[model samples]
Every structure is written in C-alpha cells, then in structure tokens.
Target: MAPIAAHPVRSAARTTLHTVTVAAAPDAVYRLVADVSEWPQVFGPTVHVDVLQEAPEEGGEQLLRIWATANGQVRNWTSRRVLDPAARTVTFRQVVSAAPVASMGGAWRIAPEGDGSRVELLHDYRAVDDDPAAEALIEQAVDRNSTAELDALKKTAELGADRAALHFSFHDSVRVDGDAADVFAFLDRADLWPERLPHVARLDLREDVVDGQPVVQHMDMDTRSPDGSTHNTTSIRVSFPDRRTLVYKQLRVPAAMTGHTGRWTVEPAAGTDGAWEVTSWHTVTLDPEGVRALLGPDATLADARAKVRHALGANSSTTLRHAKEFAEARAAGAPDGAGAEGARATT
Candidate 1:
C-alpha cells in the first residue's frame, strides 16, 4: 500500500485537551477508555478499531489500526499506544498519519474526584507539511471529536452498568440479482430516501469533497417507529465506492440505545456472476435505564434487546428487499427511480 499523502506544512505545534466529569467512579470511566475495542460502541466518531498488537496485562505498548470520522471524512491511521491501568492513563502516538495530517498523539486520563470521576483527553499534532490550513483542520477535528467523546463517556459512566443491559451485534442480508454498484447506489443515495423508503419521513444530507470526490456524508433523518413514534437521527457515514461498503455511526441514537453503529456492505456472490448480497450489520450497546423508562418497568434486558433486534431487522429487511427489486429493475435497463417503492406499490 502506498503511504498516505502528507498535508501542507505548519510551523508551530498545537495541543488540545478536553475534560468531563461523570457521576460514576474513576474505575468505571477507566474501564471504558482502556477497552479500545468498545470505542465503536461508545464513541460516535469512531467507526472501527483493529488491534494489530496487544499490550500485556501489566501494561506496555499495543499497536492499532483505526478508522474514524474526522472533519466529515473517514480517515485511517496506525498508532502505538501505551496503556497504564495502574495510573489510569492511555497514551498514543500515530505511527502513520492519514492525509492532511503530519503526526498525531494523544492521551486519556481518568482521575477520581470525590465519589465521581474526571476524564481528560489531550492531543498534540503538527500539520503534514506545516501548512496552516491543515493545522486548522486538525484543530477543528480534535475539538469536535474530543468534546463528543467526553460527553459520551460521561453519559455511559453515569449510567454505570446494568446486568439487564448488554452489548450485541447482528446482521441481516438480502441477495440481489443485479450489479453490485446498482445495489450500493440504493444505499448511498440517502437524499432520495424519503421517496424510496416510506419509513423515512425526511432527510438532510451534507457531503465533504476532496479533489471533487465525495469522501464523507453527514445525514440527518426523521422516521416513524413501528408504534408510530417519531425519531430523529444524526449520523456520519464514510463511503467506499470502490469496495462497495459504507460505515456509519449514529451521533444521536433513539432513546432505547446508548450507542449505535452499523455498516452497509455489498459483496459479489460466490460462484455466480451478476449476483450479490447486501448486508446491514449493526452493533449496539443497550441502555437499560432508557428501556425501563421508555418501555415501562416491566421491560427486561431480554425484552429491550429483542425490541432492538426486531426493529432493526424489520427496517433492514424492508430496505434490502426493496433495494433488490429496484437494483434488479435498473440493471434490466429501467430508468432511475423506477419501481423505487418496490413491486408492492399499487399506485
């Protein structure tokens, strides 16, 4: 793989730090920050993290490859992290900076404050080529991501842990007898969702372009639940047109969930040309407090989990089923938006 192109040069080093206080204890906050694997489920800016090397239980160095949304774009980089649980701090230095970045390093510290805890995130970096514009972009990303992450940590820690709540993931897929690009287009063109998906009442979309190519999409959508409850969701999505995959994180999830992230992936079917499978895969951490408050005290974790699975499955299946029909029709030379509501539409 080619090395990422460096951004413009900058002269001085820049540092940013943000902090939040949670009603929960330091241990609670530390656990959440140290367990990097759970970041995708806890932080809205993190799309995915893969541990390339693990740190020992005693705390040492671990290497990771991370994909995250920064400045409305999906960027990836490798980093070496030093974890010190005894001191309740994790320090990381980027081994390879993504485009528009020269170098990056950060640390997370959890300190006890009375019965509660204080968590601080600190980052320092210089632009790729010491470019002032690049430095400004990095500053904006650091500020935005740090603030969002600290707020999420505060919320999660304050909730503490409920055995009734658990983290879970599952996927639903539909086979489409059409070109992968056609199927992926159905997922990518979110601005048309109001006309295509009946459940979607309204949608607002924004894109970030680099060299005339759209790299990221920010979407706000309103939809009605099965019980006719209206929900509004704000999300950031990273698109990989070449790979036929899109990953997204919900910055504002429904009341029933603590955190939610998912992907829409299109894969060519094995042993069959022009046939493909589109999958909607989700991972979420349920909020038992929300469940009890929203679904009544009678609701159990099982019930909450079930409700989530059912709701997600229903929507994904509906979309997949329609996408299959629409893409197949288009592949057959029908015009765009033709049969968008699917074959069941009577009008």
Candidate 2:
C-alpha cells in the first residue's frame, strides 16, 4: 500500500472589534477618521503619517506610510486605504507590515446614533509562521492601541461647537546662514538645551539607538515661562535624519492644554548657497476648564486661543533664533565647542 500523503496546517486570522459611542455627529466623526494626516494628533499610538500616494477624487483609494508605537516599541508599515464617504466607512489593508505580523487589515465604521455617533473599529491579523507568542503580543498591542484611539476620538469629536476654537496650529521660521545638518544637530541634541537656551531650566533626555543611530528620544524638562514661573513637560521625539525633521508629542502639558505636538524641520534654502531654513510648527488642543482656571472665569475661548498663540510662538521664535546662531557660528569655522560657549554667553 502507498503511504498516505501529509499536508501542513494553516493558521486562521484573528479578529477583534472595538466600539465607542461619541457625543458628536456621524459626519464629524467620519471626517476625523478619514483624514490620515491628523492621526498623529488625534490618536495616542500614532507617531507620524506620510501619504505616499493620494487619490484624485474624494472618497477614493490612497496609500499611506505610518509610524506608530506598538507594545512600547516603534514600528512602521505601509497600508492601502479605501474611503467611502457615502457609507461612512474606511477600510485599510497593510501592504508591508513590520516583523511578527504576517498580514493585517482593518475597517472603521461610523453610524448615526441618537444625534451622536457609534464608532466601530475592526481588525484582523495573522502572526508570522503561526507563532503563538508573536500572536499574543500582537493581540495585546491591538487591544491597547484600539482602546486608546477610541477614547481619544470620542474626546476630540465631542468638542462639538468649540472644536475650531479649541484646536489650532501655527509655525515660525528663520533663515540660517549655515548648513542644514548643523541646524538639525542643534535641534536634535536636547541634552545641551540647558546651556544653549535660557528658558530651559533643567532637562533629562534619554535616547534609544539602533545601529548607532538614535531613533527615539524621551525628554523631561522644566521650562521657564516669561513670567518667571517654571512648567514641567514630558515628551517623546521621533527622528528622521534624511529629511532633517524631528517630530514630538508632549505627554505632559500646561494646565490650559489637553494636547500638544510639534515639529522641527531644517531644509536648504532654495537658490541659495550655504544657507538653510529652519521652522518650528505647533498644534494644540485647549482644555476649557483649565483655561478658565488659568486666565480667570470670565476669560473666553478666544482669550485662551490668543494667549496660547502668543506664549507658544514666543518660545518657538526663541528656539529658532538660537538654532540659527549656533549653525551660523559653526559654519564660520568657529572652534568645535565655540557655539555652545557663545550661546551660553548670550543667555
């Protein structure tokens, strides 16, 4: 008798569902989910999102590259997403996933519910080589991230009439007569900020390096405000050396802010030799009660907005000016340590 043939077994994809009831219109919730660029600010795990390819028409298909924290580690992947505004659904499939993930896909469903909205997040994934340990890790990450994302979405969407007044973004730029690399170095090295920037009273910075390159940084700092009061803040920074960009999200913010995220960018000046342009961009979400306590009960949302704009802009401009000076000095053949000395002297 011939021997019986043997076949390998296959693992089935695991599915999970997470849902939240948000006190906002369905259209508003859908809009927040459909705009991928805002995910970094709206979702806790999302670090950055880059739209690799965009569809020409609305509610079409696009490709995205995203970096996010998973299980306390940073991971990146590419995904293809299809947006359907009519149905209020967004479906995504991962084209290239990080290790331990063989494949993954998800959908966001938004439906009207009693003048509010019911948001549903569904995910399906498989582990590489059907490893049980790997699958368990992925499961935990998905649960944690999905819950955090849903909570944030509910909070942001429920801002209702005050949404526009509560959220704002602005940028400040300076032209530096130096190399872009020098400007980037100054921004990346936050450990030296206490000596270089007068506003930095104390700072503790830690970096996670891979292959001799720093990929992520955690910072705790005491910053002196213009009023001589010190504010404590904690932040996580992601670095992109090739683009000369550093993106950060503050885990701890001032009393008047619910969320804060920013970016520092260095680029060569167009049509100029040995010149660079450095810019600092900020996005913030206001907490109405915090704002009231900080600025008195009669203070309006408009007052809070103006105050935040002025305070944040002042700090950004100061940082940009210092960075410009540091880079320029370095480019002028100043000794290796002269830039730091000069900055300290100015302070």
Return the top candidate by TM-score: 2
C-alpha TM-scores of all predictions: 0.73, 0.90
Put down candidate 2 lDDT per residue, 1-347, tens digits, no spaces.
99989976877899999999999999999989988878888898887888999855567898999988899787889999999998999999999998899999999999999979999999999999989999999999999999999999999888877788898899999999987777887888888899889889999998877567777888999998877789999888988878889998887899999889999998877888868889999999888999999999999988988888888888889999998888888778877663433221111
lDDT by residue (19-79, candidate 1, tens digit) is 8888997877888888887888877789777699999988999999887878877788899
Please report how far candidate 2 places residue 221 from its true position, in Å. Answer: 2.1
Supply candidate 1's per-residue lDDT for 146: 94
Clash totals for all candidate models? 8, 0
Worst 10 residues of 2 by lDDT: 338-347
| Whole-model lDDT, model 1 | 0.83
Instruction: Measure candidate 1: CA RMSD.
Output: 7.3
